[model samples]
Target: MDETTLKENKINQQASTTEHEEFHTQYTTLNLGPTHPATHGIFQNILTMDGEIIIDSEQTCGYIHRAFEKIAERRPFYQITTLTDRLNYCSSPINNMGWHMTVEKLIGVEIPKRAQYMRVIIMELARISDHIVCNTVIGVDTGALTGFTYLFQWREKIYDIFEHICGARLTTNIGRIGGLERDFSPEVYKRINAFLAEFPKAFTEFCTLLERNRIFFDRTAKTGPISAERALNYGFTGPNLRAAGVDYDVRVADPYSSYEDFEFQIPIGVSGDTYDRFMVRQEEMWQSLKIIRQALDNMPQGKHFADVPEFYLPPKEDVYHNMEALIWHFKIVMGESDVPKGEVYHAVEGANGELGFYLVSDGGRTPYKLHFRRPCFIFYQAYPEMIRGGMLSDAIVTLSSLNVIAGELDA
Candidate 1:
């Protein structure tokens, strides 16, 4: 009787265990990214999925981490602008300007009014280019490819403006510690004006295609919705935070780089969904256009750069002709230029959010320690939470809307 009872109990227990395993195995573990196209970056997400719905997600960064902060510590102040260029490669000028502004603050060099205005124009153009990429990508994620192709031409025109100014596109190391490396050339102004005249009409057409399109609205309107309180709690900023209905723009609140001189409205959204993010960025591009136009119209008549020979690089002609200018150029290039013993933090509204530079200098040629407050890195902390319980497609669209550039995120 004991042997029969024990055998029966063992059989029942094995069957129960097998059933449990089969039931649990129905929920698959899926790797959403690391090299996936929808990721839009080298970001990796390990998603726990029940069919197509994400039950949970885990994000892994640092895949493309070049140790930018550590690199900054080794590089001189002026040379570090190149590092900033790689931080947010989508809008490298903004990163360039932000780093330059931080160094300027440390050196106590007051930039000229014209230089400030020029910086504003470049930064706003960068902003517009960045938003164009983000919004168009959102459209593409939603299966609307027309807007992306249509607007990318304008983005190239903006890049042409950058190329005319700095002779570099994508990762443009455009500005200097005191101000821009040089003033905008006539060709630069011409390209900028042409872009300004053409982009608005094209952008309006792009908006008309998507803003009210039923498929786009259905895909984005309520998907990945986050409340204002939650977004602020997660340290969200830029269009993402503005999409959550918080109007905390660094330009308006902190007013750096003569932003106070410009008149522009901060566009805010209500639901903090993908659609809100897209719309907010669309509006931001318009506001950025307004700022750019004003900056160009009221550009002061003065030197292109501040008269800080110690910090600013001398003209190439001067460097070639004058021994003193050559010496200064060598000192500036070789990290021999003196930096003050102080700590300074400067933030600018980057295309993604507030790009901040925390510089600590012990009066050394190189920074004692440099820390970058990258907004993509900060906002990415909430990705798993944002995507949990959402469909995989929604996650893709939400990510596109967030515009989490890997350079910015991993740096």
Candidate 2:
């Protein structure tokens, strides 16, 4: 090694020694993931525990690192949308929108009003699905698989809505930088409307079946509680942070894609514990329904893409007859269109927490850097804190309540 490399290594070693001296605690260490089924993805957590209470912890990752930023650097603007779907695959559309919106902002694309409303409707639908999966997993971890079944069935219906929209489910690359690939099919709308009508009955059944169970409450209530002050200090947001009694939501605090046009309530909890987090998601589902209803009520009439013929393709008829239209269509489809040079960070309300995309552009057809601010990643930081001093059972409830997805967390 060169002198510079040797010097850097020495500095790192000294830093490690200093940290160990200052932060040392008498506790046993445990490695919790990287293959654990309940980890949700490829994640490994190092825990520092003093018998039943945690003293400190460190989270180690990169087990499933595909170097997403490096991959995005090689893919075209449109191609990158598919990759974003895997970032937080449970709410793939939301991830898809965040990536596209940053690119759209860079290129100064003003999407049509119709497309904006469409994005809002589908995004809210995805949020509902994401939360249901998370909340149900909480039940499953706590030994209430019945709630998991009911909730999973409802989420399956939501996935059907996705399949109807784009002929694909899970990794739905349904949005674009300029606009959408197409409008929702009549059948898509009919199914969503039908699902909306039946949803209340299902939600009521979910509540009746799970929420009031004495055994369930005994497991969840007041167990593994974190103070509201500590949660804010930890950079938490979305339903998890809101459950700590701070009514901050990305959709309301920082509205995007016409979210401000819709009215909805933000749910909060007095105790920053597992049960409160569960309650927050359950109530937010109701608020999401309110958002969807309002967006549907005020749905408008207009073109899907704004009239950017170069970036947004013209109609097929125009493409066939007009030379300029043909050239532009070919350019966009071939990923040769010149997107602007800049960078922007955008986040939406994802199921687990704040799902953000920090994107950089080089005025080329492809992105320069793509980073996801995954909520599960930070929730893992509080793992030792959450399960410390609580029973081993509390560890299960705490993990489930955080709603960490290994795919998302590892991403």
Candidate 3:
């Protein structure tokens, strides 16, 4: 063929490609939510689409902003654990542990073996709960309300355990300065065992119901695939990063609270698509249950708290009977506890991702600066990239897939 013939063919191919754009010119764009049921929390996502296909997406934040960092800076070192609870409300226990561990590092305080084991057990349970909610919500967004009812029931059981341990359920500040507020009680033990015995069937039913459904697979399988490399560059961790085929779990890479002792697999995805994320999280729930069971069995017999009475508060009996104890309690509560002058970063395997506390102290009760390395913030950043070529409807599924809680993202 002549050069002019080749030029004409190239021009024709370009025209054909432009003519067949997934989002057609006639269709208009629609913004999904900074406040939609599918969005879980306060998060605004701007979606441009033609019919069902989404051409572009933009996620907006600052809706649930609490200025947690600024508040942390003003609070005492020990008091910051409460702030951590607000980071990922679904996984407050892990966030509480992360904040404590960072302060523990600065003070060179060693958490007891049982405390470490307990932290692992509780945090893993939170992880499983987090994944279950994300998956169930994704299912609900895709018109599978049955999945929501079944999974939410299981989630209620988990919350019941949390509420039993602490007075609150969702925002559980279960940790003390060096250990737990109290030891796991017999009642707490009984409820956990009862739930454990029954949870497997519910979990299996959840899988059998949705995992094999043709419509669910078709909606998710090849949609919103982000590459492992892109995921890393975007600074994603936890389940989101795992779905991208990078087996970089913080629990394994940087084990805190004796997580290295546990035996488990880090499930990785091949396509980094929505299907892989769903499967990866499902498998993780199984693994988390295993870890919880092991921790319960291997719980060491020792003190539930550390001997640092000055840093930690005195027991209730001592407070009532002893003048020294009363004086000490008054001092600690009044921001008179002298925290060491140092800066530390502690990262925990939160339900969402890496819930870290970057704290700087200046030998005072209050922190000089406090920064949180929120997982939802990083995971949600991949929104536009994941949905750039997918449909607008897929945004609902994709938002659930990312499992972003707006409180953490906005904070």
Candidate 4:
């Protein structure tokens, strides 16, 4: 009776377990993108989902890997700005300035106070431009297109300022090694003043459209949350880290380009959710405006570029009219100038976060080794963690809030 009863019980248990296994839910694998517009970049995300909620995710980058660091190694120091232009194109000026500062530090060139102030203004303008892209894209992902279309005009105005300063707008190799190519012209000042006066009201309206709107708040408030501790562990910076309640701003922690001379508050959020990220960037734009105003108001009177004739080029008029100036210009442009042998690291509070340049020179025209500390690349590794347990829609908004530029990721 014991052996027969035990055999029967085992069979019954096996049948019960088989039935339970059949009833268990199965997860589906979904690929978000390498070319999908919703991804906002050329990187791919492979997601495991139960219905519409994500269970697990794997990210694949390098679809557009341009090997910017390698390119930088081959190019002369002056020509490297073109490569940086594509790193965080939304804020190319910050990348451009950061590289210039790294070279300046390595060469022991003292940047003029006026040049520093000018750099501050341009960098802040680029910051605003970068934040605008992030925050507005967040709106669009949440099905709010009005804010994006409206606020983008202001970004164009910022570009106009860039165009007036240099000849180019987007991928502006805007500044020279020691300082800017030239001082601000009257037209540039007029455009800047106009932008300052007009943008605040429009930006305020853009904020109002999404900041408290019930739909925007609900779509983003608790979605894609990361704790302050987790964000730091993942190496977050800029608005993303600030949204997680970290006040570690490169501009304030290690001031460069005269950032310390200005007055502004570092805005932070509590939950590090999508809403917090959005709000943090919203407040940051205001702070950028404040810095730009201060830089303009306290504009020091002096030469725009430092007295580093080896690096900074002479005036076009001089190059055209004077034989010596023409010869010097040809030599500098032709990579005939010598660079110091050294290693240097410089970081700027880039639009996404800390945009850093680690440079190694061997007394040559090109960098021996070069690396960029792209914030987008660092924080994007946390994307899967942020979007796990949330809806597929949440993934899009979370990425938008992080503002992970594809260019930075591949570079």
Candidate 5:
């Protein structure tokens, strides 16, 4: 009686367990973000889930759309730099410099080598700042919060350098169309050197915390992987494209702002997953450091701003004390200065990817049409595809590693 009764009960128990598992295999819809912290931006994903696995997803953008391209059509060339600041606010200086370079190309104003080197230094710092926020946030999403808080201090130091240079931190209207509005002060150099010297130690610590962590690798290594062909077809650039094993860095492919002068390597990855994205950003921060050091050491000597007095604002002291300076300042600020009718496109190696500006001028105070090739907007198109078969948690880490800034995406 014992053996037969036990066998019958065991069979019944197994059947009940199977029934329970099937009952719980239900699907639900989830709103991943728009205001969700894991999103890291003002974008929303409508996710269809089977338990924790993301089955399908739809992305909603334009929550922060400020119509940047349309705004550029109305504002004068000089006024447009402020709008760029709002794009990739994490690395606004790169947007500022990219916009300025676009106008310079249109007007045929050659930036001095010194000014180019200065721009390079600032842009590289912005790159470091951008990568820091991305890589550390990737850690945060992976449940390692300490690294984010620890490395944020270095981000503040980078912001301090920005504040010193442009008198603003987050949205730095850093350079003018022809060149920088002002040269870097000795104090700014001091801050940069200090950052360069100290950041490596903290960065090393940050990497040590997560790079080889078993949990982190398990969560991120193969999650949200995309093939190189698909990534490139989607117009991927910057680290996102690089993570797919294509080494197409705009700074290397089409050098601008004297990026040709400084030597640095493009960081690449093979899997195009969250882990690769994080690793690529980590390596890029190091490359940015290398570029900054080279620019500082081999800086050229020349005026920070070009000789285009008509377009560039006059010195504040001169505006107050000299009549001609006052007139030029008025003309430049009021958008009364004329620009030659032409079309031009300029791109820079932005923190996200390729930050490009395509300008068409009608020989007017404002551009006839201006378009920004914001990398965040372009790469975000690949999000649903990337996260399609991944888990909900992997989606968060993938988004963090992509570094899709709302301002940039919506702009």
Candidate 6:
């Protein structure tokens, strides 16, 4: 009785083990980026998927890394803006202006009120330009393309303003070390007014399309949510952090370029999800418009740049005609002027988040050392955590909402 019963029991247990092995699910590894359109940039993610769900993900940066910090060490202060241009090409003016303000801080140059107001207008325009790309792309990822096409035209109009300010459009090496290269021309004012009048209606229509749409809401509402605590822990700033119900804006916390003079609300959201991120950026665009209006109305009466002729290039006409102006222009452009021996850090509320520049000058034309606190680089570290346990599609929308510009991420 004992031998026959024991053999039968062991055979039953073996059958049970075989059945368990047969029914178990097999996981798949997928490469989601580094050239994929859904990724939006040169970023790669190795994802472990359980069917359509992402269980784990590892991000790979440096695919577009160009060693911007080391390059800054070699280039002069004036030349560094060109490098910043590539950092956040979506909002190149903000990068350009941030670098200019950093050098201005290091050299103790006080930017004039008029110049500051002009900067506010340009930076806010850039912020709007950036949000247009991000929010529209989020819609596109959710299978809504009409809004993207509708609002992208306004982004081009904003680029037109940039072209009028400086000759270039994208990657504009726009402002000078002390202030802007030139004041706003009458045509620039007309363009700004035209944009101010026309853009709001188009933006409102774009918002109407996705802000309350059932499909978009279902796709983005709870996807890739992070708490305020985790967002702060992950070093989030800008719309991403604000979406987590944290209202810490670099412009409000530490005002620069006369941001303190402007009165505007900082938009915040309760959930750090894709929808919240999109909404926060939408509201911020409105606030940017408000700030731009205030700056334009209260425009100060003065020169476009600061009084530091040593750093500011002389007028083009003066350079061609006057011998002294020619020498000064040559000296400034060639980085022949000596820089102060000091260290300074300056940050601006960039389109993505807080873009900081830490500069060390040892009485040299070029920076002794330079470091950029790129928000995309910092916040992209949290991508895996944010997308864990969510669907593969959700990851795409999440990345788009975060506006993780590849240039800034790999800079």
| Candidate closer to the true structure by lDDT (higher is better), 2 or 6 | 6
Q: Write the candidate numbers in order of decreasing lDDT.
A: 6, 4, 1, 5, 3, 2
On residues 1-411, what C-alpha lDDT tens digit does candidate 1 reach at each position? 563355445545554676645665455567777999887889888776768988667788899999888887888888888888898899999999998888888889899999999999999999998998999999999998899999999999998898999899898999888888778888888888888888889988998999999988999999888899999999999999999999999999999889999899999999999999999999999999999999989989998898888888899999999999999999888889888899999999999899898889999889999999999999988888888899999999989888899998988
Candidate 3 or 2, higher lDDT:
3
Compared with the true structure, what per-residue lDDT tens digits does model 5 show for residues 1-411?
463355445545554666645665544667777798678779888776767887667788999888888888899889999999999999999999999888888888897899999998999889899888988898899899999999999999999999999899998999887888788999999999999899999999888989999998998999888899999999999999999999999898998888888788888999898899899999999989999999989988878989999888888999999999999999998999989999998998899999889899999999999999999999899998998877788888888888999999999
| Stretches > 4 Å off in candidate 6 | 1-22
* Top lDDT prediction, candidate number: 6
lDDT of 6 at 237: 93
Distance (Å) between predicted and true CA of 163, model 6?
0.5
lDDT of each: 0.88, 0.79, 0.82, 0.90, 0.88, 0.91
lDDT, candidate 4, 247-323, per-residue tens: 99999999988888889999999999999999999999999999989989999999888888778898999999999
Candidate 2 CA-lDDT value: 0.79
**TM agreement with the true structure for every prediction:** 0.94, 0.88, 0.92, 0.94, 0.93, 0.94
Supply the TM-score for candidate 4.
0.94
All models, RMSD in angstroms = 6.3, 5.5, 6.7, 7.1, 8.5, 7.5
User: 309-385, model 2: which lDDT tens digit per residue?
Assistant: 66676779999999999998899889898877788888887877888888787877777777788887776677777
Q: What is the lDDT of residue 226 in candidate 4?
A: 92
Which residue pairs collide, candidate 6? none
Which scores better on lDDT, 5 or 6? 6
- Per-residue lDDT of model 6, residues 272-363, tens digit only: 99999999999999999999999999999998898888899999999999998999899998998888899899999999999999888999
